[model samples]
Target: MTKPDLAKRPDDVSSMFDRVSRGYDLTNDVLSLGVTPYWRMRARRAIDPHPGQQVLDVACGTGTVTRILADHGSTVTGLDFSHGMIEEAIKRHGDHPNITFQQGDATQLPFDDNTFDVTTVSFGIRNVQEPKRALAEMLRVTKPGGKILVCEFSHPTNGLVNFGYDTYMNVLMPGIVKLVSSDPEAYDYLFNTIQAWPEQATFASWLREVGYEQVAHRNLTYGIVALHRGTKPAA
Candidate 1:
């Protein structure tokens, strides 16, 4: 039941993810109330992966979104800080010719500058100790004019929906996680982080501040989740 604190120390967060890797995907599916697939679909659509593109899926737990990008014809690399998560990803997707998994840090990506046509992270950026550093790294790796997308839990815009979502996260989700998650304390960390995360507009501003252009966000499920996109300046 290891759990990372709000400060999000890299070692503790990585170990926490490792502890939950065995049932990570399943638990996420359950916790997301079966909307995980829809979220992935929205993310894929936003990315619009195609042949001849080099796509990087950062913190790609279990390689789920990475596999989707590969299916759409991109050569995809799924990178995660958690070795256990990377192991699970390889176990599930090693046979895919278009996909590769690597264990790496987000703040300092392993690849060279201008290496990827598109870089994305879904439900992972918030776990980074310095989210802006990761965003900058993603920008550095992306080709000029390339795309960057992040899909994460976000604050709801509508007051009524916000209240309901808050109620669910603060009240209902704890009991549900205790029942289904192997490491319930990890999910407790998840809840806390989600609660503390910046809103969609604020996070989009972070992307802009990190040198991404054309930054925008689309709210989903009444803003319980937000998909943010940006482009590396061509010049």
Candidate 2:
């Protein structure tokens, strides 16, 4: 029942996620019309993690993408601000020797500089109260020449598609969430954040501003989602 406002106060956001931790992954699948997994696949491909790589998955809810990264033989750390979400992730993936779940703030990652070979967040950064700071943190933790990929809901580029997608988000999604989500009001916050998120190009600029180089993005699902990629400059 608890929902955070657009201000995105960390405690409020964390508590809201905790309230919705139960069935959260299933709710995402239903709300995204089963396309959530595909989006994650695209993100993983962008990073292309390898054996012995250290990858950090920020705001990893239930360790879905974390497990996907682990499947590639990478050692993945799944971090989330919500304790309940971390608990769910550990419950689901605790046995995976390659994956570890931790509760931490995105803006202040609890890791040493240049620690990870790759850092990524799927459908999570927009929830951070200070996304720019979080991006900087991601950049800070990534080793020189390492990569970062962000997969998030984005605005459609084509007019017709945009119209249809807007209608679906504004008109159809609310009703669907009410029916399927364990905490329906939390999705109201979700809708607001998606609407308020920056467009693809602008978001890519955030990575550039945070010192990532070779930044670029590709639209997926008619730009209803976008995957942004960047690399840390070699020291």
Candidate 3:
């Protein structure tokens, strides 16, 4: 598989995701030691989707978080830039009455402003070509006073844990990916992005700059992953 230029070219990133869509979730589960479900649960709780709420799950690969939102009684639209990912999502959750999937870019969402009660992206922001624009789009689409949840990998706070985490991410993860992932080299890029991402505080500031109010982040798994939450100010 051809590797995408992670620094530029959004279409390349989309194509990369398409190539890896078949084993993406399984690769995540394997690398994270099956802990991704727990992380998704935490993200769902942060958003607290309820009956009658309309949600947009941006970068909703394979509909994991989308299914969670729908199960909690919200009407959800799972959107991703990768067509293959959307195809898999629909195949898995098409029978569900409350959820729909679409192919879309986070930086240029295909919806009117203030359309959703909540907007979220899971483990996906770092992959976007323009993360700030994506955040702005997420803010624009969400209802005033509604929530925006971002779940992504973060630097661990504990020194000992950080050492372990770094070792796993830098070394063990790639080895594991080689055995399981459809595109093992992509994990190299994943490792680099995870390491390069801003910490909890810096990311919270980004949310605020994007016009989200009361922005905050909660560290999970000893800060290995974080769930950031913010509210869009009411008009």
Per-residue accuracy of model 1 over 85-152 as CA lDDT, tens digit each: 99999999989999989999999999999999999999999999999999999999999999999999
List pairs with backbone clashes in candidate 3: none
lDDT (10s digit) by residue, model 3, range 1-235? 3466558467777887888888888888988999999998899888888999999999998898999999999999999999989998998897899998999899999999999989999999988888999999999999998989999999899999999988887778777888998787778888888888999999999999989999989999999999999999999
Q: Show model 1 residue runs off by greater than 4 Å.
A: none
Candidate 3: worst 10 consecutive residues by lDDT? 1-10
Alpha-carbon deviation at 8 in model 1, angstroms: 0.3
Q: Mark the regions of model 2 whose C-alpha exceeds 4 Å error after superposition.
A: none
What is candidate 2's local distance difference test score? Answer: 0.92
Better model by lDDT: candidate 1 vs candidate 3 = 1
Give lDDT for model 1. Answer: 0.94
Per-residue accuracy of model 2 over 117-199 as CA lDDT, tens digit each: 99999999999999999999999999999999999999989999989888988899989998998788899899899999999
How well does candidate 3 match the true structure, expressed as C-alpha RMSD?
1.2
* TM-score per candidate, chains pooled: 0.98, 0.97, 0.97
